[model samples]
Target chain A: MIRLENVTKVYEGGTIAANDVSLDIPKGEFMFLVGPSGSGKSTLIRLMLRDEPVTRGKIWVAGKDITTLPKWKIPYLRRSVGTVFQDYKLLPNKTVAENVGFALEVLGRPRSVIAPQVAQVLELVGLADKAKRYPRQLSGGEQQRVSVARAFVNRPPIMLCDEPTGNLDPKTSVGIMRLLDRINRTGTTIVMATHDHAIVDAMQRRVIALDEGKVMRDDALGTYEGLGEEE
Target chain B: MSRILFLIREAFVSLRRNLLIVAGAILAVFISLTLAFGALVVNEILRINTLAWQQGVHVIAFLNDAGENGVPSNAHEVLLEDVRGWDEVDQARYVSKAEAWIEYQELFAGQEELLDIDPTILPASIRIELVDIALHNSVKFRLDQQTQVVRQVTTAADSIEQLQNLSRVLNVLGLGLAVALGLSAIVLIANTIRLAIYARREEVAIMKLVGASNWFIRVPVLLEGMIEGVAGATLAVFTVWLGSTSLARAGEGFALFRLDVGQDWFLSWGLLFLAFGAVAGIVGSLMGLSRYLRDADGTGPDTPAGF
Candidate 1:
């Protein structure tokens, strides 16, 4: 459902972020993107999110050439791909329920639909009891769960997690990974970018490793490779 | 229905959370509208007073006596008849020398010593009222040409001219002050809205990421600014009304100045002030939202969106 045909991204002043990298993931597939800092992993995710344009390649997500999509239609394209961030990205002033309901609200869904949908998603993420609490009032794991609930609230076809558990403890990271796996098993594609070896080793899913703005390895049920200690 | 209500509820919640900024916006609108309303009231009073003076204007033409100028008494009568027949003249009454002197004596009745002078020394004057006070110059020119009967023409034209000049100067000064105050108010309101938006920047950013439409984000901020503006304007109008009423009451006996703060003026000014409030609110919201939208589009946080 996602394809990058020799996609290249170059920042201003001639800095190449991703150099002629190409990849493909079939529908309902689960994949991990592994790389060190400044290794172009984030750039790949940003390109997928349409936050930045590709320099000299085409990106097709859910069978639409997003490279040729009009600016006004970018938001609608984003509605089909849910994104979770490392910081949880929950609005600090809003309650857990508000943060989760925000995604549905953006879709202009009626309250009757939003309320039940948000309730169900929050329940799935085990954050139903903390719905009334603000982000500052919740722990890191709980806040991450709220973010997960928000990302999945609209039932997007694909979920992109950019270091979703980077700030959590190992046990909490495992829990988030398990939640993601549960979501993946329900027939939705999942693509995560991270450098965590333990989690990648535990998942035993397809992995794509990048080094110096180039894709170094791609394997099904692969192990973390080509990154030394202090990554 | 519930979604709209939820949006409104969220807007109010955000407003309450950012009360200090909202208060600042209200204060800016209040001060600006107060100055504007006060100027409007003063302008209205000046206009009414000018109209009254214009309507009450009369010209008095003094006739040359037959003993001094060797003009026949019949010449003076014929001149009076000619002046009376002018189309511009609304009404004319001939004042005999004795009658003019008697009127002067009555005016200075408290000073009996000055009233002993000869009444015959006063000149016979013809008082003329013009149908239109603005045609004073034309009537004056016509009377000045008749030197055989009229020695000199005196009119309220000079006084009216001076008053008009003063009113024009006052209007320019008021406009300058209003413009300066309006700019200051815009700056103050923009700052207030900026602060409110800054406080909620995280929520705004999240909304953008979630694909919220521009209107969904802008409407709340606009409503907040509008509420503050309307409240401030209403208070300002009330204050000005009370001030005008009190001033009119205090000056009733003294007659230093008179103001007609009647229902019409109140209604008109009140509506104008309300409109000012709405404009201030809309401007503030636009300023705030422009920056927010720009930042959401991946530019610097303070970049303004092109409207």
Candidate 2:
């Protein structure tokens, strides 16, 4: 339930991050944005979150035009759209439970409400036993799981990820993909930008490739790179 | 409300996390405010003593005994009666030749040559008290011009004038010093808050990303600044009180000036200092939060490193 029509993002130093790009994804679709560096993959995610303003186009998420949304309304936009980063941006000092519960806490949810939701998400991500452990105390995969739990704690309908498994081993990446797949099975839409060919090929989900700020390919059940494109 | 309690708890948690930085901020406020309050107290001390001295004698006019300006020998009595009727004059009395001679002998009893001088040589003075001490110059000029009824005049006006000038200068300089120091303390506090925020920047980034409002992030940091400021103010007020009390106690044996200002005066100022401390802390917190809040909007320095 996200639509971007002729959206473009231009940086100050004359770098066009997203150049007249357009896309539409129906509800409950798990899609991968496959692109090389500087191909506007992250820019698409940022524009969806309204973290960066679109230079010349409209973006609608969940039937509302987010490009016209005021600055103060951006937080509410973010609440409906969960975000995850490659580095697993968890507060190092907080335990896994606190980090996960932080999602609801920022929403001004009461402790009674936040506690159960955080526990459920941690269980879903398979980190139920390590709730008390700090981020540094957990492995790379565990830390990424904690980040995933934080993103999913509020039970948002849409999850946007920028390389969710970039820093993890292949086996860890599989675990993360399985967790994402489980979440997707619950009818939540997921758009992930990635550089991982093996992961994308194995999942065989919808793939959209971009190059030089323009969409190159959009396919259902697509591989990371079609048989001929080597790089 | 639970909201307020949550903010307070969060603020205290941050202060505890950065104990060293918090201490530095409080110490800065303390030192600056101490100097500020100290200057105010010193100026007040001088004012109280000046009031005590001014109450003693307003103006004393020494009359001529020779009557050289066509004045009668009995002019001392006439001058005293005339001064008593003047609007400026509060009370006036004639000191006769015999009284003047006796006062002369009591003053020079240890001097052989001064004791042998003739009694008529000493002037029979008409001591004139004024309605207000500030009217000294007007009365002095009037008496000095009274050549027909009086020959000469003397007053304690010069000393009082000097003291008033000194107090005026001190008032300006003291306040200037206080304002400058207060500003520096504000800057120091802003820097301290910045340091605290920097240490927890990742937490801030996570909070922003997870849909925390900017105000939600700002409340606790503002509270921390306020705590540090109030702590500094308490130390400053106590130190000023101790200093003034000790100075007043030491001046007990010295009868020339009264050092103790009543507690009411100090009590009000102490409360004011505390309020000032709280405001300064808030101002500093706002200053420190400017960049951080701007960054939280989107692409800040703390943005996560990623693809």
Candidate 3:
């Protein structure tokens, strides 16, 4: 579950990133955030992750007030909410297995647990055979899948994907989205931010639209609204 | 404990992958430590030689002429007895005018013609040896106050004073050179670490996003620094030992130049160099991580969703 109460964010000098927005999503629900570039969609996700502090409000993730959590506790908070970025952010020097195992290693997990858990996650992401391959050795779709494997390897309660498919072709994007859908189906709450109208309309998931730092709509099973009259 | 092992494993892997940077850092530490330890050995040798010279020499006192407040014949016997009574005085002998002339003649034997002068014209004197030549100045000062029996006192004071000044100057110069080399070593190490860090900046940012603690991120860099430092220091100690031993053996053939590198000195300096190398490595890691850690904490411009 996630909640935001009258949150606003301002960047250097007086540029508004997010302005006076509030929303809530229940546990185990999948949601899509749709907006154009610079529309505060990324800002909303950043605030939830505590990557940037809200200039003037409170944020709660998984029933804990992250806004008031100490800096030392930020790492523990992040362990419960997995995040994937537009860039896969995989270490080019590391193999697929090493990349996935890295998340658990940061958590100081035991070797006995880490070895088997990493193998299971890699297999779940359909990369069981590519575990030994480096990121550069894989295709863009496969790299994104590795990133997804890394994010979900620890089985966090919530997953946030910020334009994860932004760098791939349309076909690869579809494959990545399907992988995310499969992940969501297993009962981990998923929130993805994107500008892709076609994927949004096709998935027919709950949508939250933003325009100019304010939330414009929150619709269940919503279409990609405000996109040139829905084509 | 397992976390530490994991960190150490990662650090080893990273160091192996970046072998050239590690080598460069090691080389820097080695050269700096070698220069520093070499100077230290040179200083120790100078100190020992100076001590030997001070211990080998005795003081020489010159007496005033007869009628110029000259010492009485009986007073001369009393002065000699008093000098012999002191515990520090190993031997005291009276040098009459005739004996002084004979000693001067023997000293300048090449000029035999000058030795025929009347011995009675030479002044009376006393030759005194102390248990240790370092007490020469104190003995001279104590006897000079006896104006009734002694007029002027002179020992190897000027030579000893000059040696002391030279030692002080050499030490200061060595220290200045060591400090300059140390700073250069730090810069070299910092640059090496920066390049290594830059190569893995993406991985570091990902780790930050995944909730890795600052210590978790720092351990690898610090380990890398330690490895370089230890390797370099070992090399330096080996080189110093080899060089000193070779020089000492070579000096055996030329007895005029005695090069004595004692075992205690070698062991102590070797340990000192190793410690210095470790400190240098840690300093370099700290310098490189300062900027990177600040950026990763979200205080810098690029907040990559992880900080």
DockQ, prediction 2 = 0.43
lDDT of 3 by residue, B42-96 (tens): 7777777776665544676666544455546477777778888987788777787
Candidate 1: regions farther than 4 A off: B63-84, B90-125, B131-137, B145-151, B254-256, B299-307
Each prediction's RMSD to truth: 4.0, 3.7, 4.7
Model 2: per-residue Cα lDDT over A163-199, one tens digit each: 8998999999999999999989988999999879999
Distance (Å) between predicted and true CA of B94, model 2? 7.6
Q: For residues A87-107, write the lDDT of model 3, one tens digit per residue.
A: 898988899998999889999
DockQ of predictions, in order shown: 0.35, 0.43, 0.41
| Shift in Å, residue B37, candidate 2 | 1.6
Residue pairs in candidate 1 whose N, alpha carbon or C atoms collide under 3 angstroms: none
**The 10-residue segment with the lowest total lDDT in model 3 chain A:** A222-231
Clashing pairs for predicted structure model 2, backbone only: none
Least lDDT summed over 10 consecutive residues: which range in candidate 2 chain B?
B298-307
lDDT (Cα atoms) of all candidates against the true structure: 0.82, 0.84, 0.82
Off by over 4 Å in 2: A227-231, B53-56, B63-81, B90-134, B145-151, B299-307
Cα RMSD, model 3: 4.7
Model 1 is docked with a DockQ of 0.35
